[model samples]
Target: MTIEKTETINITSPLDIETVEKLHAGDRVLLSGVIYVARDAAHKRLVHALDQGEELPFDPKGQTLYYMGPSPAPPGRKIGSVGPTTSTRMDSYTPRLLAAGVRAMIGKGSRSAEVRESIKEYKAVYFVATGGAGALLHRTIKNVEPVAYEDLGAEAVLRLLVEDFPLIVANDIYGGDVFEQGRAEYRRGGN
Candidate 1:
């Protein structure tokens, strides 16, 4: 199949509804600013805290969450080998977080139908980072600090200050899903 040229879009975190609304599936993005890092363990805790009527470690409103875990920093660097995890593992908790006002998420794969619906209903977006490119991904992280669930070690939720973090829109607020589209195109012989 031939690849279409997609313009790279530059965006910042703490994204607003207006910004998310403008994004579409298949568009490439360079995300800058703050993003919270969380994995399955951290996701569970965040949802549990919400269930107990407690505030999250960081405000979800207008913010982006990256489903990643970082290896221990090597020497002077602040982080090492940060990469996106499989998004499906976090699907069950995603709708709740989206409902709580998270504007976007960065991960590596397709989402569940329910999560896709929630993305539309909540005006949020899902982005896919390149899998198996942890070393390259780490270059964009300008700062990293522990945020919550310290005992989880690498799985702990941390705050990341990123510049030009690479991603592609996997699902958009308008019900667009790039994975589905790509599959359909392939089946149709890329016509």
Candidate 2:
């Protein structure tokens, strides 16, 4: 489904810090605000930044990071078809990111054990977008600008203003995981 991008939304729902810590698997959300963009390369750079005691390019506290590497947009488009990439590749850097104050991650697949535990410990959430549904996601994005790390190709960081973009919680701080639930619902030759 496509939703036309309209007014820029400001997500002011302080997201009850306690409730945010309990976001559950299969829950849907309308992210009416800003989020940071990061990918495999940017994750590496961030860890190194931590090692050097440098401030992250953006604040992680109460912030969400979308794990993606987008295709260049064609003329007249705010951004190319953008969607979350597989997330397991980010496992190594996630604990560190969580420690640095990140409260959520948006991506396509399930997180590793270490990442999931960190979410539990840090009061964080993991949201999921439709896999392979880039064209549809693009309709929700109205503009694009980078905050940092511009030399890493599409892996460079960028900020996007999105409106009512659809997503489902894949993992939450409460130890629930959607992938497991989905798998349990379906089995070999079974629906």
Candidate 3:
């Protein structure tokens, strides 16, 4: 079923668990409004940007950062094989970003305890996409445009406009995690 919300979700954290739990895997979400884009290299620079007292490229408040490193797209395509990468690499930068007011993250796989704790302390949610589904994922992305950090190449940050982006709920404000849920549910021999 397609889950749709027309009103731009004005998320003012500390986010609530109930609100986050409502989201689930295979949900079709249209996230509008503002969000920050951070990859491995860019994240490091952001941490230092803080130390330098420089204004962040984008405000973290009421925003989400998608952890994806898109392949260089062929001409006439919005994006190329855009998919979520490993999340652990960003573990170190996540807490700080959360502290700065990031409310959600879109990526694949599990994150470290430090990141999960930050989610609880900061009231954030972690959204995961199925691995090895780039072709499927791309179908959900309706638009793509570059946003700062272009000098970093494809690793450059970008503001993507997605239409009914499909995703799974990995972690949420309440500490509910899909990665764990599946393990416990299937371990009992449900499969």
TM-score of 1: 0.94
Ranking by TM-score: 1, 2, 3
Give the runs in model 1 whose Cα sits over 4 Å from its true position. 1-6, 188-191
**Candidate 1's C-alpha lDDT?**
0.92
* Residue runs of model 2 more than 4 Å from their true location after superposition: 2-16, 188-191
Judged by lDDT, which candidate is best?
A: 1
The total number of steric clashes, by the backbone 3 Å criterion, in model 3 comes to: 0
Put down candidate 3 lDDT per residue, 1-191, tens digits, no spaces. 24345532323223344556565533334444334456898888887888788878777775778888887778998888877888889998999888877778888888998899898788778877666778777776667777678899867877766655656667866677787778876686545
Question: What are the lDDT figures for the candidates, one per model?
Answer: 0.92, 0.81, 0.72
Can you tell me which runs of candidate 3 are displaced by over 4 Å?
1-36, 188-191
| C-alpha positional error of residue 128 in candidate 2 after TM-score superposition, expressed in Å | 1.0
Mark the 10 consecutive residues where model 1 has the least summed lDDT.
1-10
Error of 3 at 109 (Å): 1.1
- In Å, residue 79's CA in model 3 sits off its true spot by 1.5
Instruction: Write down the TM-score of every candidate.
Output: 0.94, 0.89, 0.81
1 against 3, candidate with superior lDDT:
1
As a whole number from 0 to 100, the lDDT of residue 191 in candidate 2 is 48
